[model samples]
Target chain A: MCQLLGMNSKNPADIGFSFAGFRARGGLTDDHVDGFGIAYFEPTGLRLYCDNRAAMDSPLAELVSQTRVKADNTIVHIRKSDDQLLSNAHPFTREIWGEAWVFSHNGKMTIKDAADSDPIKQGKSRHYCPVGDTDSEFAFCYLLNQLKEQFEYKPDARTLYEFLTVQCRFLANYGLFNCLMSNGEWMLGYANTLLFHVTRQTPFGSAALIDVDVTMDFETVNETDDVMTVLATTPLTSDEDWQQLAVDECIIFAEGHMVYQDVPTRPVYLSIEEGLKIAKNA
Target chain B: MCQLLGMNSKNPADIGFSFAGFRARGGLTDDHVDGFGIAYFEPTGLRLYCDNRAAMDSPLAELVSQTRVKADNTIVHIRKSDDQLLSNAHPFTREIWGEAWVFSHNGKMTIKDAADSDPIKQGKSRHYCPVGDTDSEFAFCYLLNQLKEQFEYKPDARTLYEFLTVQCRFLANYGLFNCLMSNGEWMLGYANTLLFHVTRQTPFGSAALIDVDVTMDFETVNETDDVMTVLATTPLTSDEDWQQLAVDECIIFAEGHMVYQDVPTRPVYLSIEEGLKIAKNA
Candidate 1:
């Protein structure tokens, strides 16, 4: 199992506060420290930094934490891969329709490369191939391949949301498939077992971190009309309310607001602790 | 009218010394202060950093200079675009055949997006498209599209060199089109107007930077078996004997040694100053 932290803001915002607390889980408060990566979507380009080292110890991570680069959308991951290779680091990116798409996975999937010969897996490696050997990257490529095969150009936000909901549900059948994806314009989060999100708007109050000795007053950081949404595998703050997504649920947030959501019928709820145990045993 | 710096080494080597000199051109030394970027190829992946700010003023570039991340292959660029946008910053990266390809250009081209309808420009935007409006990126997409159309997978280095030599010459017909490209394993440099290179091996001596006051003793930094080749739009070190590539020349370097070189018949020789004037007027 890994850890994920995603942020989407109506305007460019700094993620240092949320990231400071979340990065503590990468071998400081909890152990998910095979590697770590973060992607910050600048106005027109993306800045990606990945290190095959514990986020708590990596100098690159320290640089990222210290340098407050304002971005519209950001994705961070602390990996727990069996093989500590740089290629397996999360927050993989691919360019589609002249836009860069970033993806990160938190849970293990039972899908194997040998099954790529199946009809469903065809063209997965043809249009977009995984540079790494991780099942997460393989799955990301499959998703992009499907999108490319269906559309010659980038589709509208609503169309993409509808397509992604069904595709994400299908992927969850493979196993625990918690993921976060973004193209800078919108963030899509899917939870098979455990994922939580919180939105902060005007009249915001202070929030205390769960893992670190830090408190931030959102009122001071955000402007009058600012809105932002943050998603994580687990809640990073102790005071604010964080809503857990239902199993097999897919949600899309754009401009700091939830635009679409789909919840499967007869969803099976699972606790974070239970999910961690199963992930460890796998 | 940009600046380029590239390195290929037999062993992972620190490029801080050369980068310090090259970065000065972004603001302190010469006026190419539109944007800057650098790509470092790690053992299994790549780390890319780009900033729209002048390299001398960018904190990110300062961090990059302070943190000496060793890499086997590296590419850096300081831009001078009319529109100083982050998207126009080089070096640009694209994934081809599951390998990340990095490219940076220092010259102007007359190629326009309207030319996509031409037979020679077929699939240029379909297979790969430029996110920015720069002619340099458009040319890069065209190059990659041509390579993809011809080869299903990454071809051998020799075959790629031969194919690229022809393609680069064809692109030069549009205008000055000097560029450097790499896929981590090898580096391909083409000089339509101006380019220079220097190689350092055992028994290396000290060299002084032309832009900065720093000097480095290569013998103290490199091992006996280590070899490195540095390529740039202009000679960076004052004391080293740099070799200038002839116009319409294409060269490939791997493991710090030149693997292939092609010089066209009746090649026109242009000085670096002359090339810069032509680029600025473009």
Candidate 2:
């Protein structure tokens, strides 16, 4: 599998503090060394950095960690490749209705089954398709195509949030579907099993990393009005109260606050034998 | 206006040597310092680095100059933004047929003219549109939309090349239209006024930079079978025999060779007064 990290802020902010620890998992602290990627949305424009090299040793990742590219929304991913190719690197991006939509996944799905039922193959997903051969990208294309089919242009925020929650449930049925998606204006996070989030507001304090010997004093760097929320596959900081999400839960965030959330009415779980069958086909 | 640089190679190659001098024009040597961007096609995937900071001072650009990221096709642009916004940065990319088509322009065109006739505005360009408000991106969207309208999937190389040549002529009629576009497989360069190209092959030798105090001995690093072609708004090296394109000529390059060329039969030059009017509208 892979790891995911995301941030949504009321003001432009840097992820260097969090990224420093998150990237250590790419090779230094853990075994996910296949590749890593990150996407930052500076309002309407986007800055993306991706490398097929291990983030622990990648020069680009080093530069990213040192440079403070401030943005309101950001997503990062580190991969342990089931398919060893640069094309399958995470944080895949696509444009929809003149807005760039970025996505990264942290779990596995049955590629053969997804492709067999792909709307793109059925000629319904004419507007978007996956550039890489990853099941994650295929799932993203399907979801975007469904959105395009439902609305000629972007729908209201509430409508979009509701539609995505229903779609996330359907996708989770295929396999473990933990994902982070953003379109510059808002961020949507879905947890099939493991996900955690933490919000830092006015009374910001010092936070220490769980993976590295690094600590950041937020009070010194941030204004009193600044608010930021971070989401990750695993908690990056040891001192913060990271709220864990339940299985099949989805949350939408904007301007550092949770605007909407959907908690599954009845918990659904897949057995180990069923998961093994999907993995074998994949 | 912006500076454009592109590379097409027979083998995966690093462009650090050429990029070093080109980036100097962003601030140190010239005044095109509003922003800069570069795209590297990694076979089936893409790696893009962009900043709304001066390339001469950007740490990302410094890292790129030192890191040897090998790619078969690469495009870089340094901008002097008439409109100071990150969304207006160069090398705008959109996906077509599951392949990223990257584009950057060096001169201005009348945005009003392009928008009036935009296929997307007419409900025809369903596959792609511009995320930013720039004449360059508007023109790119127009070109890509025309291509998608002509072919359901990617056409043969020859057919696509021929169609692009005709389209370039039409776009050049609107205003100054020197541009570079690529789809990883091939590069197409069109010039309304300024464009130059140089191809380095088996007998490669030392080359001196034009904007920086740097010289590279290519023979030490390249194999005998290596062939690489570079396109730029101005020649980067002082020692190479760079060929200038005619006013309305388009060249298609693949594997460091020019596979096709289209020259206008009769040049249509816009008068200074007419160009001023278009610039004012833009």
CA-lDDT, candidates in order: 0.87, 0.83
CA lDDT for candidate 1: 0.87
lDDT of 2 by residue, A1-282 (tens): 788999999998999999999999989898788888989998648888888878898887888887788899999999877555667888888877888899998788764465655533454347676777887887788788888878888899999999998877777777778899999988899987777899998899999998999999999999999999999987899999988776788998899999998877785544435433443443
Candidate 2 chain A least-lDDT 10 residues: A271-280
Residue runs of model 1 more than 4 Å from their true location after superposition: B113-116
Candidate 1 chain A minimal-lDDT segment of 10 residues: A113-122
lDDT per residue for candidate 1 within A228-252, as digits (tens), equals: 9999988999999999888888999
Q: Against the hidden reference, what TM-scores do the models get?
A: 0.97, 0.92
Model 2, first chain, TM-score of 0.91
> DockQ scores for all the models shown?
0.60, 0.62
By summed lDDT, the worst window of 10 consecutive residues in model 2 chain B runs over B271-280
True contacts kept of each: 0.46, 0.66
